[model samples]
Target: MEKFIGLVGTNSDNSTNRKLLQFMEKYFADKAQIEIIEIKDLPIFNKPEDKQIPEQVQLIADKIDAASGVIISTPEYDHAVPASLINALNWLSYGIFPFVDKAVMITGASYGTLGSSRAQLHLRQILDSPELKARIMPSSEFLLSHSLQAFDEEGRLNNGEHIEKLEGLFEDFLTFVKITNQLNHAHSINKKEAENFSWEEI
Candidate 1:
């Protein structure tokens, strides 16, 4: 089976975002192997002069680099993704280009009706940055609003409509990953550019 990384985009123990990823890991077990990667263990990014990542961050980066694709489930915080997710991305891009040209799918859940719309848009901009350059699955989004009640005791989404949409997007992502791998002719150049990238120069 194909392997994917379900990146939990928050550090909160009670995060619905984490629950969403867990649900995906199980619900999509037949289609792919989804390994849920957490960012809770990582510390804040300080942009160290040496450009060395924390041990845990490196381990997480390796998993992402090796994965066929990534699914990021985020929560809205101040109309944007949580600080923890930003911190994790910062560390991942400091010296490693694990996300370069990698297929990515953005999903978000929220207590409100917009379903983290703003946060998802912000994340898209971040992933499109020069250092990240993730090949995001476009024109598709899985937004789970009223997330607190979106799942049942079994941790599965209760809404048939939501499940239907999610299933379609997940299948789209699988195809997207295969198509993205074909666009890797410039992968080395992208990685080199990212490794030598600096904010001060731009």
Candidate 2:
């Protein structure tokens, strides 16, 4: 089965975002292998003079670099992506590029009605940066509103419509991964450019 990295975009202990990815890991067990990665306890990013990548960060980068695709689940904080996710990405990108030309699916959970819409948009912009260059799945948005109640005791989605939507998006992502593989002729170029690109220099 094709493997995908599931990024829990928070360091919170009781994050619904983590729950969302966990649900996907089980729900899509028959179709794909989803490995959920946590971003907690990592030190904040400091521009290293030697450009050395941290061991944990390198491990995460390797997983993402080897995966078929990625699923990033985020929760809105102050109408933006949380700082923890940003910090993680900062570590993953500094002198190491794992997201270049990689297929990504973004999901977000919110307590309010908007369902982390702003955060998702912000994350999309971040991934679109030259240093990242992630090929995010187009025309797709999975928002889990009132996410605290969206799941059941068994961690399965309670709403039938939500399940149906997730199913369709999951299928689309699988196809997107396949298409991304075919479009990798430019991947090396992108990776080189990203590696050379530096946020601090710019």
Candidate 3:
């Protein structure tokens, strides 16, 4: 089964973004496994301390490495991505590079009008950095604005339009993950073959 890591960008117990991720986990349960990764226990990134990676950080890194793709649910803070999320990415950037060539889909929920759109854009830039190099979904973004009223009492998204869009985006993202995995597998095989090639054999 294809596994996808869900990164919740907030530390709040009542975070709307967390709820959003939960919905996604259930929605995609049959298609792919979505494991929500908690960042609360991760220590702030430090260069010197990175030589001996923290156990929590290593554990999350291992999960990311094993997953076929990632989905991040973020909440905008002062028109920027949450510091907790950025800190987690910073840790991954140092030596892990778990995001390198990994397929990622970004979504967010906010009480504002833009639905964390600005924050998602900022996140895309960060993921595009040399160290991270994540491959994000190209066309659609799942943004839930006015999120307080977006969900029903049962915790499912109430807006039919939003649900339709999310379904489409998820389908596209799945295809993207499959294609990326195939390409990466082929690249690894080619690299191994080149490594074993000898001039005497040629």
Candidate 4:
């Protein structure tokens, strides 16, 4: 099956986080069809009781709905994930809940030694819910400390170990997606069976 990956980057232009996402794209070039979603294009989350959703928000929801899995490459801003990311999540959770039952993975990088750890933690918290099925890697495993020293001019991950780690994460994400999709299929089948069953005389 073709794996549909949605890459969400919090930057508008060239950024370390975007570079890292590009690297992942290269790694999964042939195996998956990757779609890049820019936070810059999205508007702030605004909820009104009787108002319709904006076209941009609907566009994002459609992308999330179409994707099989989501990979968020977030940057830390003042020791937290960007407001744009949070805003996007808020919009997604309001009515669409596009994240529900979706497989997700998060990787972060920064110039600081902590390497976006705080941001990743906050993201995990925000995304924590019964409906949002995510397979998050440990903080220790998904880090890019001193990212400026690690990547090349063409936005490639130079460290072989880091590349290997990312490849492993991608594999794990794919596995998780496959399992979840299969479970959904099984659930549908069971529901049909239950609904189609007829009453019998004892």
TM-scores of the models, in the given order?
A: 0.98, 0.97, 0.89, 0.82
Model 3 spans > 4 angstroms off = 185-202
Give the range of the ten consecutive residues with the poorest summed lDDT in model 2: 193-202
Q: 1-202 in candidate 4: lDDT tens per residue?
A: 4556555657457668878877777768877877777777777767666546677877876887788877888778898998888877766665455665566788888888888888888888777743243444443347888988988777788899888888887787777777777656445444344334333521
Decoy 1 TM-score against native: 0.98
lDDT of 2 by residue, 122-190 (tens): 999999988889999998899999998998999888999999999999999999999999998888889
> Which scores higher on TM-score, 1 or 3?
1
Error at 170, model 3, angstroms:
0.5
Each model's lDDT = 0.93, 0.93, 0.85, 0.71
Off by over 4 Å in 4: 130-141, 185-202
Q: Order the numbered candidates by TM-score, best leading.
A: 1, 2, 3, 4
lDDT of 1 by residue, 130-190 (tens): 8998899999878899999999999999999999999999999999999999998999999
How much is the lDDT of residue 30 in candidate 4? 79
TM-score of 2: 0.97
